[model samples]
Target: MRRDRIAAIVGIAESDIGVTPDKTVLQLQAQAAVRALTDAGLHTRDVQALFCAGAWTTWTNLMLAEYLGIQPIYTDSTNIGGSSFEAHVGHAVAGIQAGLFEVALIVYGSTQRSQRLRGKVPGEVSLTEQYEAPFGLPVPVGAYAMAAMRHMYEYGTRPEQLAEVAVAARQWAMQNPRAFARDPLSVEDVLASRMICEPLHLYDCCLVTDGGGAIVVTSERVARQCRHKPIWVLGHAETHTHHTLLSMPDVTSTGAAVTGPRAMAMAGIRHDDVDVAEIYDSFTITVIVTLEALGFCQQGEGGAFVSGGRIAPGGSFPMNTNGGGLSYCHPGMYGIFLLIEAALQLRGDAGMRQVPNAQIALVHGTGVQLSSSATVVLGRD
Candidate 1:
């Protein structure tokens, strides 16, 4: 049986993404949800489903539904690291198609920057943590650093090549008034920045910020009456490569190797047909690996592919138009923000950072050192 062709994104909203110290995670989630509902010209009463995900926050779907004065028929609190938000879109689409519910609200919020604490271990420790954390592989930077070093050794990748990603993201951030990393950086700047890990410098990492983002999905019939033009979900696919760094087959690739072709085939589009892309950038290496996995370049050519101003603002493929997690705000898991930015660009709502005549967009999300991957193809309808 063919899956139901249901669910179109009708509205998207995000709070001021940088250093929002005053708001709690719940408040940020509520504000973003209300804004999205308002943008869709719908009342709180119209919402019938809610999906939320994050770490270090409340699992308050019912509480939020009560706060918004709506009674949701269905609720989800799935947490799959950063890719949770994007995964929710796929789940919501399936739910709607299965006649479980309609008008689902997927939201994410975090206050990582304002909260300070002594270096403490995360609440839940996986088996991988039991094995690796004992050996000083505690944080994400360290895990990705090993991957970067391997790529450099095998592919002759240069530090300058990784710096190019950060530089291009900052250039786009300069154009985005709401972007967090407004200050631009050069290759020299990146190389000179303080080292967090041996291969990954301070500039090569994503920022910690306080922010929230939300998206409203509804059946196509309802989207026709919403405030903004609907950005149809042409196709979407997801894959889990591994749960831990040690279990991965190769550090230099991602589950995108599987997800990219599956999603493109579902959308009936090719790489050349994609007009814009918003690949998640939790680390510079994430982008490089994804670029190669998604057919932007050959397996070991990501470094050369990103060189010479290819991903800059006015280049052939303008990536991370809202500055990405690199130059934009990476409030913990930043995959949701990617979907928000991509939807806005497809709707033609991005003022200055908008890509001209953009009709097709490819948005990708990565979680936990390439553990989980999701790709969505969006089209203007």
Candidate 2:
């Protein structure tokens, strides 16, 4: 028997994406919050809990509550990197189940691209920085490159396989008008693109664009009165094995190995039941490694799994239908966008790139240094 859903995403929306020089991060978040609330046919006054995560601004949840003119009874600003928003969905569900709150707003916004802060030096140096700064390993790309190198050595994963990920993401982007880089892309094109880190080319990396998104989670009873069909939160889980690349248990693996099975068990769904997926593509290697960890394919088989356009539009397994971070707008944290896309796909609201009969969606996020992961299983009734 299918487990009863305790909460559902009632509304979802994205702020002005790509480039928004005029809007502040808070403004972007507020825009998304209002739009999402409006989409739900609810107002700020109805929000009982607020959830947010962002390093661009301090006190994100507090600032958002004040900006939206709401005094939420509960607030969470969990900063587990890009996966924070996915974790928030689980948190919201727990709060609702505990009868602590009814309406929860989860929001995220970033101006990383506009402010040219994608790789800026942090004001404070940490333990990870102390060990990594001297080596000149570019914050995240270098870490991913190291993992790619290891995966290649152990699994004989080829560079072309990695390029296939970029190619497939671009193929989906071509179908999404909101995608940032929708131009025709090919495997050859990805291989020929400028190299950012070893093995990972420019095309293999996710776009650094300004974007923001929000989602409203509420009890099933409250969701029934919303503007759209409630996309039920079937299951969710998150975990992190390390805070730095140096501390990672294994470069070829991610936290998804632990979270995937747990979340799936909670949702009571098998891998074949997922109609669509929105896995974070911070880098091409990120997707390959994550898919392996998520058990979509056996370890080291991610290369073969993603090749032959298997994950592209009209393929055996449709994924990242919104173009993903590789082609879509990837602000500092891409987790919130993952949830937003999953909710849209589950709602059957995606227009040109909508996956047919997308009843169950698997949304996964990889955080900084591939150290953290969060997975959520969503379904339509």
Please tell me which predicted candidate would have the highest TM-score against the true structure: 2
Q: Point to the candidate with the largest lDDT.
A: 2
Where is model 2 poorest over a 10-residue stretch in terms of lDDT?
Answer: 120-129
For residues 76-97, write the lDDT of model 2, one tens digit per residue: 9988899999999999999999
List candidate 1 stretches off by more than 4 Å.
1-5, 58-60, 117-119, 122-126
- lDDT score, candidate 1, position 105: 90
After TM-score superposition, the amount by which residue 77's alpha carbon in candidate 1 deviates from its true location, in angstroms, is 2.0
Off by over 4 Å in 2: none
Per-residue error for 190 in candidate 1, Å, reads 0.5
Q: lDDT of all predictions, in order shown?
A: 0.85, 0.91
Candidate 2 residue-pair clash tally: 0
At residue 282, give the lDDT of candidate 2: 92
Q: TM-score for all predictions?
A: 0.95, 0.98
